[model samples]
Target chain A: MKTETKAVDIDRDKGDFAYPEVHVRDAGRGLSEKTIHYISDVKEDPDWVREFRLRGLKTFLEKPLPTHWASKDLEAIDFDKIRYYLSPGTGAKRSWEEVPDDIKRTFERLGIPEQERKFLAGVEAQFDSEAVYSNIKKAVGEQGVIFVGSTEGLKNHPEIFRKWFGKVIPIGDNKFSALNSAVFSGGSFIYVPPGVKVKHPLQAYFRINAESFGQFERTLIIADEGSEVTYMEGCTAPKFETVALHSAVVELVALKGAKLQYITVQNWSSNVFNLVTKRGLAHEDAEIKWIDCNIGSRLTMKYPGVVLKGRKSRGEVLSIALANNGQHQDTGAKMIHAADETTSNIISKSISIGTGRATYRGLVHVPKHLKHCKNNTECDALLINATSRTDTYPAITVRGTGNSVQHEASVSQVSAEQIFYMQQRGLTEAQAMSLSVNGFVNDLVRQFPMEYSVELKRLIELEMEGSVG
Target chain B: MNELRVENLHVAIGDQQIVRGLSLAVPRGEVHAVMGPNGSGKSTLAKVMAGHPDYHVTKGKITMDSEDLLALEPDDRARKGLFLAFQYPSEVPGVTIANFLRAALQSRLPEGEEMEATEYYAKLYEKMELLGMDRSFTSRAVNEGFSGGEKKRTEILQLAMLEPKYAVLDETDSGLDIDALKTVAHGVNSLRGSKIGILLITHYQRILNYIVPDHVHVMVQGRIVRSGGKELALELEERGYDWARAGADEPVLTR
Candidate 1:
């Protein structure tokens, strides 16, 4: 019931400011065996993890960028120019007071603490290569749910962490995944106990504060049998003159009869390249849903996927991407039906403003042996200017009898008459355009949580400003 | 000066002229009907008054009260107490009626000022009730998937909610049945007061039977050829538009 006027008060430049870096440890510039060894030595990683890092580095060095189907803008990235790791050299703090003063101010400016106090059951805030603060409500933690940094999860719960680490998205899955595996740090690791449903969402906030840096955070979430949980993550980076890189890998596992929803809202600076790999595995009668919103970034390449591995498993992805001037948002979803009677749905909406470009690349597969599997996919694009561009590529392979698949795609522009109609009702040009854009993605945005949905609408309005003359 | 006045308005779309040397005025507290045949430039006048970008006002002046309406943007003109209810309202997909009206009202407020949600919904519900609209209609997308009668009713609902000094309703009775026409006329009549003026544009005189105008003007070839009291509408309804076209060459008899 919040009024639209009140929501417009959100500061559009909240993510444009940066503070000086205060890191005690630095992995130095460039990606090499020496850099990986420095990161491993600093974290005091075990021999297995150190060897895993070496193998990931090897794969990263051998693989080539997937330029055949991706934008040639990928050729502009310089791996040797980025600082792979920079940490404040402090372990994840349990109290907000223990966080560094400058880091606390950063999260405070972003309104993280207030949000945690309001609705979040637990929160983990990451600045650069390490999590500065991590906490969970005592009442929720008493229910046997474990939420902690990935490093702590590796050290404290290796039995649960090691079994699924790199099992869903292996190091060689893609070039960016391989690069992330080589030097990943500071993402959330969560596990909901069997039959103990988490009542509230667990959130993680990632901030990259340094210049000429690369952030590679790896996240993993596993919902046990008959349990339900929702995890949300948000990311932002300060505007830097030089190019930065953000490559992340996220894996989700939903056990028998479990439901897990993962939501992400990332607003990076225009000077950053965002390349990420996210996928989930659903067991018998389990459900996995992904709600992703990508707003900024010079070039973003992401396609969150799901593998329906057990009978009657369900998967759904609802995505919203906005590409303003001088940016490209390349995003979509994937569904692989490996079991009988599995169902999946993918709905994606994108907006391209000015000369920005958006692309949707999707894949849905059902083998000949599978029976009665169904899949539905819809992708819609909105172009706000004459120069705006969008593209769609959907590959669906359904070979089995009685299996069905449906695909719908559309590309449309805001007509001049529509704007005039809105204007005659007392809306300015920019307000009219923003309202139209919000309406275009309204259904998908409703999938987000209440707070995030409001924030998303405000962000869309901010982007629409100055889009019309 | 206390009127929505157009002085020798000349309008065109690209190379073609639509409204040529048209002049009219509707004073506050009066309902004026402009009866015209198809392609007689009635809708063009409505569009020009609303500042539609496609229409260029080559030579003319549109004023509300003593202020120049042609000098402002469409949204600014609307905020300054001018409204245009289109014959074919655009279908803005996924934007519910409640949100659309809220945004429109919000734009009229000064910066940093917020609209009171309770008062807004109360007024909105009252207006919708006045227009014979269901309460559930607030959540539906504007004009999308709406029946012909429903669209006209929604237009009246908006006209009631955003109370302007002057309203130009173009073909509001075009796609309406007799019952819907009566309902829409009732809504319009309820809003007629000393503070508002109305200019109802239509092709037929059927709607005039329900909501009688104080004055009637017959238009031919983008110019008002005749003007009179309410009897003029009855005369036209009886004789048809051929009688108006026959007198296009004669000087206008303004009353």
Candidate 2:
């Protein structure tokens, strides 16, 4: 029998409260060269970094929204009305006691400190446009592991940070990536030295506490040869009348014989548009894995990709998405095999409830010269109501000899008979619905860390409440 | 009034009348066997009694120990001590038997009170052992890829674990081999006690040789035409359901 923990008290409105904005720096609403310059000046960006921002801003203005195949919701994002940047100016604190009271209380309410104390090797708490508190455990620091805010990493470890910065995902990769590169402020930067495997995960929590604002954080992690690390990040935003935009760019690099696992659990409120660009590069004999769970967003478009650049490297993506009423989750994965003898796997499961919609778009490619490459993709969608919707589009191209690729997709509905069966066994309608949903994603959930899996289950249960009569 | 009683019951599925003016009572500490032919609505009666949403009770009253069962939701009715063993149990993929039973039992507890894990596992293992199920059976998905006999055994396993005040077993022996049927019957028979009532519905009297109900009722179309002691099952077995259908044209008020 499974050990039952007390039901996590995740009230539906737990993340609905916000504090008054107290910022020493606020680049007024709208995006332009002047806004990028203001953000660069306030953040004390170096000359080259400033130039990079200018180039990124130019690219952002040139690229258009990907409306050709994407949802028409892309037309709803009004960049001119969103505040590009806002920072408290107090910089990151090394101690929870030193954090500003208002910001500290927000993280406390989110249980960040307790989580850090329990199992995390380090923790970074970012509010709005900057990291308010960042600290790594002394034991981990002694092992030469560097975990810090992205700005600090750029200043202190330019040798490593600059080498991989915007390398995995270029500045002009997409409109959102370019937008994030232009005004990015707060996200984690992590590095593990050669042959040093971190025993515990490092975590980052991003909170949006302002209205009509856009949060653009840049995160980059590099694992040296023969090293291993796992990093997890979570995001949440309070409900707002006006739309909030969260556009982030995350790049990961795994050198030869190294291993890296990155996980993200995003719980944006109903009025947030979460468009993010995340990708990783794996060297010879290295491995990269992405575990993602998305819920509680108005619309989200993210497809974390992995480029296998070295022979015998491996890449895997396991994702779960749930779309409640008026929400759309368009998420998937991409694997580009650039070397021979590489393998990649992608498994995605999505659920749609009420008028919610979920779509899975995936891509897998193996060039003609890449021999002995393999890829397997599986996408499954579950619809909870008559009005719910789901779709899948997988593009696979394999052109080399001795290479193999397979794709499978399915759509299912939670039948009335199934609900009645569970109900007759004493589960309430909502409870039965949650149980069925959890069951649908059980295999993928088993791949997450214990704490995250528990939290994911609670979030799903909270979303299922009030969804049934 | 320690009994499950259906009075002048009429149930339908979207304009298709399935159970018409049927009435029966199974009191605590007794088992009532319902014998019927194909399309006689035996399964509909069981589903309706357990509050399946598709079957609408246009005119009826279902009560357990003087409490109105129809007023409650299916889950509430189950917690209020009613159970139904489906003829074709649904395959709840990825939900283990252990977890499903735990949720069922957990729903019965007062809010904020949790079932102790040790005591629960001990009880669960004891029930599985009584049903001749291996310990690992708890980890398999509920009824997914289960053999015909395994499904029936699972139903009995749930019945034993929940310990409901009343149960309606619908065609519990339809696809079981003799050995599997005997094992399942043994599991059900062990749970017979003073605090529980059971309504066992079956097409064949063969299961009666094992479960041996205290009362037997012959139903035709939608109503019971005859009621008697255990010997009624044998008489019908000898004469076939054609004997019962001969009188179905006229309603017999056996109550």
Candidate 3:
């Protein structure tokens, strides 16, 4: 029997639309001390936040480029040529009417507000660097849940904000995290009160409307004791001849007996370099899951991690990545068993089409002292074209005597016989190919909410067009 | 007259000929059983009819109702009403039987015309019931982890749903028990009518007891050695294929 009441289920937003440029303030083509301070001053940060930004900038400069893996693609991004910050000058709009005409049209075309009105508990839409609109249902708000932009959350609820800020994933966690810390402007900050469960998902839509620019949003989600919440995010950028950089840092905290599920569907354009760091800390008997899907990007390097901090905590990561022509998706999961009797699971599926390459790099660790800790990891790859490529590197460390870790990985080509079988059932060759590729990722796709599942299927079908001649 | 006719069909896999100078014809409303020993190319003939890319038809003429079947792609042949129940059905992981059947049925409709989901599901359930399949089976992946009997039953279910004008069932009874064989044969028999023609290929004569073919042909060395009524299956069952092989192999002086 399939249970639909899980904490990490799926949902979706529809439509494909973008608006023309309107940049009121552009932190012009460069990353320097001045650019960092410029972003800080524009946001009117407190003394400590400003100092934190400068320190992050220092660390980002000192940290060398990632030389181990994905280095060749990393060299393609020109940091000096990227604009650090951009905004349309309009602040967060409380009403749909309050939003600018062009930006409102863009969101309308993307069907953001319609989805919010239909099912989302709350929505925060970030166009460039700042969220242009934010809203939460009154009933959910009355339940003492707070959903707002990170900047606003810092200003309004500093006590709650400062307690966990940079705590789960501190600065210097990685080079991209450092860069995000230095210039992060807009993302969601959500806090669900103790014992309250938010039924519908809280979504954040990240849109990169400007070319040759970067959007670094920071998200922090904290579920109080015994509370539950699901947060889903989607991202897209317009196609550009030059590279656009999107590097984000997300920190999630699940207190004692709490549960949180974070989902991301990133469909950036082929010229976008998406490097992100997302991690969660789970307390006693708490559960944290990251359901991630990466469909588009020139090169993406992200591995959502979970640290099981207390006894009997549970962590999971379900990931699906598709790499098309001229794309490389390097994604996986990391689980750290810090307490005894904890459990973790990681399932990653990827598809590489027509010269595209996909790599699964995962890490699972159980320290020597933790007893009865268990982990299961499965990574499967489907190569659509003969020239398509895939690689897997799973680094598992088990030190304790009572720990059990099972890791399985396989790479398979879409069998010609299977396609022929489907084709013999009256489907065209392209239809057969799409069905096979969709089947390759269907197990993970089912974990999504019904609407998102349908949309994901459609997106896959569109991507599969012309994959075969 | 709807008929699938093959005239001196010669098929090869690479340089090795698998089906050499085989000729057969199945007209509408008729059931033809081809009983052959191992490697006599019964399965190869079925695959060749399905346009399997592995098999190269060196010289042959296959026409369905005067349309050249060999020139069409596999899917086009299927859409034009040719079905092949594979001896070993491929396992399609993660694609549900319901979805797979829907895609097949949907492809037969005109472009931009959607299949009525309620009507489609109703028909699917009716066919599954005819095949003695549980309703839950529709949600399972197509042939993934299915038992031998279940796989064969699912193939019959597809044949009923497709209602193809011509179906070549290759070794559909190979791995089934008596009860499963009865169920599969009943499903195939239920679809029997004047609009459909079935070519049942098998090594054993057991399934013929249930399906009761209209005619039986003894195949040896990729050619039809003998043709007779349904009683011929019983004759082959009593006297092994060696008699037919020896009778058909008397060297003819073609020069």
Candidate 4:
């Protein structure tokens, strides 16, 4: 028997996930050492944070550009041409009402305030380099839930933050993470008290409205023993003629008997390079789940992950990525089973239309002596046009015996007969293609938070339009 | 009177002619059964009728209610009221039965017209009950991992839901047991009426018992050579088609 809970799951934010109608005065100067130092001097960060940025800036200068995958996209981002920073709103607001008019208008267009008022336990809106508005509901605050920007978390809870920061993903984990660690500004910091089950979700919004800018945010969530929390992060960059950079680092910690879910829906215009690092740690009997959907961006490289550090832990990554013209969504998940009796399931679905390409690059590693572990992975890609391309490169490393790992990958065109069958039922070829595509990702789409799922379907529909015609 | 008529239809794949000038007609409200040998283009005819796009309709015209079915795109032909219940229904991963049917039905509406979700589900449940299908089946992917009988039953369910002007059911009883055959045939039998015409293709005579046909045809080498009543199925079932083909393959005066 199945327990079905039905609530309105459609029209998930009719306008919620769209790029903010942000007005920018690109009427500005370019990045320089002076502006860099000015930025360091403005935030009033600790001496160590300043030195860290200076060192990172030097590394960012000396390090060669990424030469491996997605090199063409990496070449498009011109650092000297980028502005590096912008302050649309000066300081964080204790309440969303205190946010400025223009930024407030932006969120109003993106449906953040209403979403926060209606559903979320808390909401964080990061304007340019810092979160301008952050407020938690009284009931959630009563539960001792810590929700704020990562900058604040580092400033206030340095003892707890420093120990875990850069631990899972070190400074030089890759070229971009190192860039993020150097100049990271706003993101989110969440802590669920022990035994506290936050029923409502907490969400953060990241918007980059300036041209030739870099928005690096860092988010961390630590769900304590026996706690549960669902955190969501969404990003939208303005439609710019020049390339912008948005590199983020998200770390999640699920302690013993705890559950932590990290969800992201990124829709940057085709002029942005969205490279991000997201990973979580799951302790004994803990669970970590990542539901990621990538719709827009010139190129995106993110793989939300989970490390099973405790026995009997569970990890899952469900994703749906739609790539249209001029987009390359190279995203998937990672699962590492360090302890025994851990189980992991990864389902990745992608649709490539026009000249777009969607790649599923994932990893599942079960170390030696990990008895009774199970890993199942299934990746399916649908090529909507002859020119479109899709690929799946899943690395499943099972080191020890007594473990079962199953991996299946397939790339196929729609059956001409299936299209005809649906068309015969009165749908046009485009409608049939849309129906088939929807069905292709229905299993993974169902895993999204209801509202998000609806929005996802609509976004896919828009992405597929005119492909068949 | 409206009709789904195949006129001297010939279908070929590459150089091989799978269907050879076969002719048949199913007027509205009647059910015709074409029982053929292992292949004899039974499934091929069903696919070509559904506009499978794999075979070339080298020499044929499929018309529904006086409309040239072959002249239209496959999906266009379908929207104009032609449906094919596949013998091997493709398992559409991730798409639920309810959603697929909804898209099909929604496509039938006039532009800008919307369907009422509540009423659609109510009618869907009623049709599901008639087919003896569990309501939970609506949430399952279309034919994904279904049993033989379940797949056939799903075809029939789609037939009923679509309410097409004409339906070409290809090998609808191949994998089903007797019980499933009865249930599936019952569903088909219940849908037979003035608004819909059915052309049932089968390899075995077993299904004809439950779904009695108004006319029965014997197909051999992609051509239908004999037309008779229900008794012909028994003749072919008991005597087989080779003798029938032998009866017709007489050497004519060298002309």
Q: Listing candidates in order, what is each one's chain A TM-score?
A: 0.86, 0.86, 0.85, 0.81
In angstroms, how far off is A310's CA in candidate 2?
0.8
lDDT of each residue in A1-469, candidate 2, tens digit only:
1222333223334343232233457788998989988998888998878888888899999999999999999899889999888764322223333223443344444445454421111112233323332234455678898887788789889999999998999989999999988888888788999999999887664222211123688889999999999998874322222237889899999999999999988877677789999999999999999999888778999999999999999999999999988999999999999999999999999999899999999999999988999999999999998889999989899996899999999999877888999999999999999898888998898899987787677667777777788
Model 3 chain A weakest 10-residue run by lDDT: A8-17
Q: Which stretches of candidate 2 lie above 4 Å from their native place?
A: A1-20, A89-137, A206-214, A235-243
Evaluated against the true structure, the overall lDDT of model 2 is: 0.84
The residue-level lDDT of candidate 4 at B237 comes to 90
Q: In model 2, which residue pairs have backbone atoms overlapping below 3 Å? A: none
Residue A344, model 1: Cα distance from true site in angstroms? 0.6
Per-prediction count of colliding residue pairs?
Answer: 0, 0, 2, 1
DockQ of predicted model 4: 0.55
Instruction: Give the DockQ (2 decimals) of all models.
Output: 0.89, 0.81, 0.81, 0.55
Q: What share of the true interface contacts does each candidate keep?
A: 0.89, 0.82, 0.84, 0.82
Question: Candidate 4, residues A266-383: lDDT per residue as tens digits?
Answer: 7666666888988889999999999888877778888888989999999999887888887898988899999999999898888899999999988999988889999999898999
Q: Please write out the lDDT profile of model 3 over residues B117-177, one tens digit for every residue.
A: 9998899999999889999999999999999999999999999999899999999999999
Cα distance off (Å), candidate 4, residue A392: 3.7
> By TM-score, who's the top model here?
1
Report the lDDT tens digits of candidate 1 across residue range A1-469. Answer: 1112111111234333232233468787899999999999987888888888899999999999899989999999988888888763221223333233433344444445454421121112233323332234455578988877777788889899999999999999999999999998877788899998898787664222211123688888999999999988874322221227899899999999999999998887677799999999999999999999998888999999999999999999999999999899999999999999999999999999999999999999999999999999999999999999999999999996999999999999999999999999999999999999999999988888987887677778877878998
Q: RMSD for each model, in Å, please?
A: 6.3, 6.5, 7.6, 8.4
